[model samples]
Target chain A: MLYVELIAQGLIQGSIYALIALGLTLVYGLLRILHVAHAAFFTLGGYVGVVVANQTGSLAAAIVAAMIVAGLGGIVVFRLCYQPILHQPPFVPLIASIGLYIAAEELFRIVFGPSGLTYKYAFLQGEVELLGFLRFKTGELVVVFGSAAIIGVLSLLQTRTRIGVACQATVSDPQMAESFGISLSRVGDINFFVGSALAAFAGVMVSVLNNMVEPTMGSVPSYKALAIIVLGGLGSVRGTLVAALVLGVVESFGTIYLGHFLDRNAIAFAFLILVLMWRPQGLFARS
Target chain B: MLRLERFSCGYGLFRAVSELELEVPHGTITGLIGPNGAGKSSTLMCVAGHVNLLAGSIVFDELDIGGLPATERVRRGIAIAPEGRRLFKDLSVEDNLRVGGLIHPAGRFKADRDYVLSLFPRLGERLGSLAANLSGGEQQMLSIGRALMARPKLIMIDELSLGLMPKMVDLCYDALLRLKQDGMTILLVEQNTDRVLSVADHVCVLESGHAVWSGNAADARNDPTLAAAYLGLH
Candidate 1:
């Protein structure tokens, strides 16, 4: 029962990391930028969903509103912030993103509150039997299947659609993409929109899972997603997903076994350090 | 038709090409020949809106295009088979060609792809193969075929024969001639002065970003100084 609970928690949290990291992977893959403010989108999405769900009492409405709001926020951030510093220096855009992250956190504090907010979701509350001995929350199961569905849809978009092919082509060669009449600016904007929406979706899902939304909640997961992308290979979607799951499970098991001295974050970082020391090029990256 | 006057373009704080004037009229092949570091590639890139243009204007069909972005330039029927063959190495040959014709309707993919395959039949065999896996000659063929997919009014070929086998060069030149007969305007840059001069309607020789001579191909062939010094003619 303990093992089942631990594994289930790990998988649910890992799926959130995977979802958020997909956005990071897309931005990094195409624009070659880290986009730290992606966390802000996630955080904002949670807040938006919470407010809307509280008011409208409809999870569907809140989810739709949060995604749309976060998606637009992404486009705006790209145009106003990221685009200006695109060709400056390597760290220029990165620093800009970090600055945006800080500003967004402050903005959230001002708009919402500095404290955390919790939800009383009447739907899918409490735990149900998972095999014979193990019990799991209905919400956790929804998370597992829901995130999987999102990842599947995203993968299909990237692999099967023409626009997705264009995105891949742009990622490979920006100059060639432009020559072929595929606007790089347009691609950047579209990617920013998609990536931000994914981040927001993960934010809302994680908030619902925990039944708590905090302004600082976006940071740990966002940073963990970043670490996962680096560990999985920066631009490889498959790699990011695998690395996210591994980190989630490692953090989970470490928290369970390591006792009160070491936290999940510390365990995650220690694992990251070991992974970096072992495979600097990333575990699944191709040469 | 394409025209440039007093055009200077380069990387930041350093000009690669300067004060160039040339006009390529309809249905003609203009050979642009120069030695290494003569800004041949830079000039083409600037015209394609990739490099920084410091001064002057680019006129295509008498409309000023110097202010346009690369994709807008491509939309206005200008295409380039860039010097490095810059094919998306991860994508298959068919995918590369499909991207080339992206400005057009989706329904046109098959027809445009078929047209390119007809020009470079080798690409048809390697349609499913990644561009990185192709030989140098096949890559060059794919590059040119990819450009042809754009259905451009003017096609620019930079170093069309460079690093290509004689047979492959012959095939590419044959396709260029076919395109010319189909009423396409061509601007060809080449290290092979003999081949360029043989097929070119007019020739412009650039040395160190300056035009040393410009005339009909026959006239350039007849001039003693240009023939001996630039064209390697005795």
Candidate 2:
């Protein structure tokens, strides 16, 4: 029963990780940029979600507001920051992303206060009994089921729609896509919007689950997502998902079993190093 | 019809084509034939808005399109099947075509796809397969077919026969001829001088980024000095 509870906790955490990592994977897949600043969007979403929920006292409104803010912010960042340096070396934009992320963290501290913000209203606060004996938080259920639904919709959009096909073409061959009239800029805009929105959603969920939102809240997940993407294989969405879930489970188990020797994050990184050493191409990467 | 007047295009600090004047009439095939480094591909890329046009104007159907982006150029009815057949390798053949027709309404997709399938029936059989899985010839065919999905009034083909089997080349050329008969303007850059001469209504022979000779196909074929000197034909 304890193992089952731990497994459930791991999966819930993994679902949130998957949400954050998907954004990183999408941006990396489209532009080959590491997008470290994605964490800023996540932080911004948490702030937006908290402020809106506090003011209106509605969770749905908070989520919607957070998504809009983060999605549009992503487009602005892509246009003003990443687009200009895209023609340069890959590291140029990556460094810019890191710089932007640091700047955003500092800005958030200045604006939102260095201390942190807490949810004013109690939402998804109760625990539900599941499968006759097990217990689960309503927030955990929402995180798992919500993340799965969003990922499902995203996959469907990529596979079933015209814009999705155009995006895929642009990803595979930008110049060729341009020759066929698919604008690379448009594709970049859409990718950044979608990816950033997902990150923001994760931020809101995390804030709700933890009942806290702070400037430094995005820092851990940012690096964790980076590790997950690299471990899953950069630019591979499905790999990122699997890696996120696996890392979540490992961390959940390791926090109890291996806490005496190493920290949870250390365990995740160690796992990444092992996996990379074994299959440098990544678990799901096509050789 | 498409007209390039004093067109100069190149990569940054490196001129690939300079002050090249050329014209492709409607319902005709114009062949630009040259040896390696003769700016054949560069000329086509410039017209397609892929390469930078340093000077002069690209007039397509009386619209000055020199400053337009590649996507706008496609909307104005110009498309290209570029060198190396740069298809979306992860996408299915049908998806590649769908992306090509992105500017059009979704309602028009079926007709455009059907038209492309008619041109390259082999694509119909492998629409479900990924682009990377196709053979070289099929890839080339799909590349051309993808461009056709845009329903362009003018199509520019770079290295139409390069890396293609003779049988595949013949099939591609046959499709080009059919496109011409259907009143589509074609600007083709080819290394196969003989094939170009046989099919091209007009021919321009480029050498070192300059037009060495420009004339009708009959005139080019009849001029033994021009043929032997530039066309490498005795």
Candidate 3:
């Protein structure tokens, strides 16, 4: 029974990781920005969702508000800090992203205070038995379905729309896309906004599961998502999704069976090292 | 038709092209040739709106388009197949063509893609293949095909014969002339003066960012003294 429950929990956790990886992969693939500040935006979304829900007593409003805030923050960061560094080397923007990340984290801390906050809603906390040995909470089940829905919608948008086509072009070659009359800045800004919103959605899922939120919650997940991106293959969405699922299952089983005392981070690092040494081009490199 | 009057452009104050004046009339091939660093590319970049005009004006179809952005210029029927073929290497050949046709209205992309593919049958054969995998000559054909998808009124090709076998260069120029006969206005920038002079209606020679000579291709071809002086061969 414990083993089955652990597997279920691991799947749910993997879904959240996949959400984070989805956004990270989009921005990294298109704009080639490390965008470390995205993690802070993720934490901000959770806090915002809880605060909005607590104030309005409406889960829908809370989720909308969280996505909107994170999306707007993404636009601002892309326009003000990152876009100007398009012609510069990679290191400048990366350092700038770090500074922005720290600034956003501090700002979140100041606004909501240093401690964690909880959403005392019963809808999320409630759980039901699926079978004699299997049980799942409302939030956990919601995470699974909600993530699938979002991913499905995003894939559709990427494949079918004009903006999606332009985004693919920009990711493939910004200069060539420009020659084709596609505005790199506009596509890049929109992608950033969308990616951040997705990250925010993932944050809300995490908050519902843990029943609490803190400003620093994004740091670990950010590293994990980056690892997922590297493992999946840079600029490859499908690869990131697979990597996220694999990471979630491995980490969950590692924590339970191998003991929580083990440094699970070593798993990510070793995987990264192996990937870099074996296939520096990434596992499913498009070009 | 494209015309540049007293066009000066550069990086900051260091002038790359200074007070250059030139013209490519409607449905005619104009070849721009110069020695290395004689500002052939700088002039093309300025006309394409990739480089800012430091002074003077660029008039494309009688509109002052010098101040427009690169993408905006491209949208206004100005297309440049930049040096080195600047392809979106990760994208499939079809996607690259689709991107080139992005400025067109929604209903026209499929038709444009078909037309461009027909122009370069090699690209049609490899439509689903990644562009990075294409050979250099194939990549050049794809670049030209991609630019053709834009349906531009005027197309500027920089260094059309660079890093290609002599036979491939001949084939490319033949294709370019066919495009010209199909009513596409062309501004050909090349270091291979002999080939360009063979096909151009008019030839303009630039030396150190200034137009040193301009005349009919036949006149320039027959006058060795004039050709030698203008081409820096004397």
Candidate 4:
């Protein structure tokens, strides 16, 4: 019964991780930028959601408002800090992103103060029993189901839409895509907006699950996302999905079984190291 | 229909072509022939807006397109089948073609796609397969077909017959002729001088980024200096 409960918890937790990996993979696939500020956007989303939900007392509006604000923030970051130096070395944009991440984290500190916060909601606090041994919170169910639906939709969008195909083409070969009349810069901007939006949503989802929000909440999850991206393969959406779920389950078990020595958060890195040592290219990375 | 007057282009601090004056009149095949590193690809890429244009102008339909980006140039009716046939390896043949025509009206998608299928019937057969799954010859055909889907007035094909069987090359040249008859302008860069001379209306031979010779294909074929030195026509 405890095992099943842990597994359920891991599945819910993994959904949020998958969301972060999905954003990382999406932006990395197109722009090849590390985009550390994406994690900052995650923190931004939590703050935005917190304020909106508290003021209006609506979770739906909070998530919507968070997505919009973080999405626009993504576009602004892309235009200002990222796009101009795209022609530079890959490390150049990566370093700029790191700088942006630090600056944004500090801004959050100034605005929200140097402490943690959580949302207060009655509907989100209740729990429901599933099967004989599994009982999950309403918030946990939302995390699992919502992440699955969003990921499913994103997968469909990537394979079915014109912009999605264009993004894939650009990823494969930028020069050829350009010759074929695809604007490389334009595609990068759209991807940044999308990837950042996903991060924003994931941020709120994670907050909803824990009933806690903090400026530094994205810090640990962001590292876990990097690990998840590597585990699934650098730029593969399907890989990220599977890797995130497996990781979430593993972390949950590790917390229960190896809880004394290894914290639940630290398990992500431990698994990442194991996966990397075993498969250098990741589980789903193509040659 | 396309003109490059004193056009100079290259990577930073390295000029690939200098003071190059060239023109492809509307509805003509201008075969640009040269050895490796002779700037044939650079010139074609320059016209397609890939290589940086450090000097001069690229005038098309009385509009200067030198400063425009690659997609903007494509929007203005210019396309290129770049070197190495850089197809979207993960995408199906149909999806690759669709992406090529994204800038054009969605209504013409079927018409333009049908036109390309007519040109390369093999592509029609393999429309559902990933580009990476295709043979080298088939990939080349698909690359050209993708460029055609844009409905561009001028199409520049780099190394049109590179790394393909002779029969496949003949088929590609046949498509080129058919395209020419349809009133399309072509700037074809090739190493196969004899094959280029066989059908090209005009020819430009580059040596060390300079236009060493430019004239009607017949004159180029008869010129003993060019025949033995560059074209190997003898």
Candidate 5:
């Protein structure tokens, strides 16, 4: 049925949103920044993935290259921009991130042309039959599997590694973490790089699903992801996923039942206001 | 041996400890006793490389450790149980010890963890509980135990008796005595002058950021002039 297909599409979109939100939540949780340029990283990743795939003629190589570049971009941004403004007022970085976002968008437009480009990754096209009533596009399946894999690896890293332990400690108390000899700056760099890399991967997924990429394609997804992150909770990873899926399903059903005339932006804003009014801290804020 | 030569350390332009010349020979317990704002914690911070020195040199076993970071200092066998018992509150008591052992120059987690648990048997019973869930006395014990996991040659503790019941303080001091018996050199900073001096081999009194009196604990206890001059008490 069309309803099932719409649900499938929404779920795939939600997975990508969840990925972006995960990264955004992480950097915000650690550094307490809004990181308005996060969407810029997403768009950057899409363009990079396309260029890399065309150059290498391999999807895996393209995704990996996209991730590396985005990760490094995150590190560079932290080192060159965030580091200098660490002691300044909160608004300094917020305004600075806006500048960064604009700069990244302009750079992308200049490099890739203002017009959107079509993706030619043959492997990502076509559909597969699932159960009797369910079906999924190859890209949708990739979104499901790829996002899960990335989340799994990150969870393992967070719970097991020394760097991860140090990060958690730094989040708890930067001064105390420093006393233990953990470098807060290095942790910031790593968190930024890794988080942006995940967003970059989501960008790649979006490009594959839509069969096209644009300079400002990340704009809508980033906004939705940010909304999802807030709805879930500021720093709660599990909450991000749950909130993303719920939003995805709700939007899917809303579009079908209430007619396409119901603007998604309005719906999202209404939901955000309602939730914040009821629970200002989000659903599962870590206390 | 750890030696400080006219060491002055503080935050920014404000000096908390100045002209502090002291030494803790290997395998000895040294107490730094003073009233509030007398720079006992600053002196320990200087030795532990947590505070930047404004002037003078801190030499640990003949190495100028002024340029070293805190972890490097710990790697070189200088560990600190800082003021306020700053534990990783969200982490389990066992995980706290795990991270403490992570900075160890080399070791197996299970083995070193077991060793730390053995040293603080109370921690063994609460290994699964988060650090914040532990009582103040238990958290203090966990902090000290974490430092011990590093197997440092010199351990500097600040206000080990802070915010604890009198009985808990006795238990904490008993552990300090045991650490001494096991041949760990220590620098203890506290306002509990009588309590620290009673067990200390040597005692240094800091007043207005300068060493006002330095002598054997017996001498500090016996000399009325030095005692009154340092703390305005006998």
Candidate 6:
């Protein structure tokens, strides 16, 4: 019974990780830039959700508002921070991203205060019993099912749509895609918009689960997402998904069994190291 | 249909092609022939808006498209089957064509794809295969077919016979002739002087980014000096 409960919790957590990491992987795949500031978008989403939901008293409005703000913010960051330095070495944009992330975190702290904001009204407060013995929170169910639905639609869009095929072409070869009349700038805008929107959605869901919105909320998940992308194989979407779920389950188990010596987050890095040592190319990378 | 006036292009500082004037009239095949590093590919790439156009104007269909990006140029009916056949290796052959025809309405996709398949029927059988898995000749065919998907008025092909079986080469050249018959303009760059001389209506020989020789293909074949000096024929 404990094993099943842990598995359920891990899978729910994995869904959030997958949502956040998908955005990171997409941006990395297109521009080869590590968008560390993505976490800031995540943080921004939570604040937006909390404020909107509190004021308007509508969860849907909060989600939509958060997505729009974060999506547009992501595009602005790309234009201001990444575009000018794109011609430089990869490290230039990466350093800029790190700086931007730090600045965003500080800005949030200044604006939202250090203590963070909590939900004014109860959200999905009840728990439901599953099968014969297990009980799960309604918020947990929402996160898992909502994330799964979003990912399903995204996968279908990537495989079945014209723009989706165009995105893949651009990823495979930008110059050739350009020659074929697929604008790289347009693709970049779409990628940043969609990726950031997904991150924002994850943020809203996490806020609903915890009933709190904090400036530093994104820090742990952001670094963990970075680790997941590398563990999955850089620039590979499917690999990142698998890595996220695996990391979630490992961390879930490790938290209980190794609580005496290791922290919950430390287990993620340790597992990453072990997996990389065994399969350096990543779980799904074509070796 | 396509003209370059006092054109100069290259990388940031190093000039690969200098001031040059060339034209491809409507419904004709114009060949650009040169040795390696003579800027044959650069010239085509510049026209396709891939390289830096350092100076001068690229007038296509009486429109000066010197400042347009590659995607806009494709919209204006300029397409290139670039050297190296840079097909999207991970995409299926069908999806590659879809991307090529992305600017057109979705309703036009089937017709364009069918036209490409008609031109290279082998692509029909392998539409599901990843481009990286295709043979060298098939990749070349798909490259040309992908360009054709845009339904361009002028199609530029660079290094058309670089690494293909002779039979495949013949098939591609035949497709060019068929495209010509359909009133499509062609700008061909090739090291195969003999092949260019065999079919090109107008020939321009570039040396160190200058047009060292320009005339009808007949005149080029009959001139002993040009034949011996550049065509590798005595």
Residue by residue across A125-182, what tens digits does model 2's lDDT show? 8999999888888988998999999999988999899988888888898888887788
The residue-level lDDT of candidate 1 at A131 comes to 75
Quote each prediction's TM-score: 0.95, 0.96, 0.88, 0.97, 0.91, 0.96
Which regions of candidate 6 are displaced past 4 Å?
none
Question: DockQ scores for all the models shown?
Answer: 0.77, 0.82, 0.64, 0.80, 0.45, 0.87
Q: In candidate 3 chain B, what residue range of length 10 has the lowest lDDT sum?
A: B225-234
Once fitted onto the true fold, the runs of candidate 5 whose alpha carbons sit more than 4 angstroms away are A1-10, A254-262, B224-234
lDDT minimum window of 10 residues, candidate 1 chain A: A117-126
Candidate 3's DockQ: 0.64
Give me the iRMSD of candidate 6, please.
0.7
Give one digit per residue, the lDDT tens place, for model 1 in B33-127. 98988888898999898999998888999999999999999899999999999998888888888888888998998988887787788889999
Measured by DockQ, the strongest candidate is: 6
Kindly list the per-residue Cα lDDT of model 2 for residues B156-184, writing each as its tens digit.
88888898899999989999988988889
Question: Cα lDDT of model 6 overall?
Answer: 0.91
Ranking by DockQ: 6, 2, 4, 1, 3, 5
Model 6, position A275, has a per-residue lDDT of 88
Candidate 2 chain B, run of 10 with poorest lDDT: B225-234
Question: For model 2, what is the C-alpha lDDT against the true structure?
Answer: 0.91
Please report the TM-score between candidate 5 and the true structure: 0.91
**Clashes (candidate 4):** 0
Candidate 4 clashes between residue pairs 3 or more apart in a chain or in different chains: none
Q: Considering only N, C-alpha and C atoms within 3 Å, which residue pairs clash in candidate 6?
A: none
Clashing pairs in 5: none
TM-score of chain A of each: 0.95, 0.98, 0.93, 0.95, 0.94, 0.97
Candidate 4 local lDDT, B96-199, one digit each (tens): 99888988777888999999999999899999999999998899999999999888999999898899999899889999999999999999999999999988
The lDDT values for all models are 0.87, 0.91, 0.83, 0.87, 0.83, 0.91
> What are the per-residue Cα lDDT tens digits for candidate 6 across A52-113?
99999988899999999999998888888888888999999999999999999899899999
Give me the runs in candidate 3 sitting further than 4 Å from their true place.
A1-11, A55-61, A85-89, A124-135, A263-287, B12-14, B163-171, B207-210, B226-234
CAPRI-style grade of the A/B interface in model 3? medium
**Local lDDT at A66 for model 6:** 95
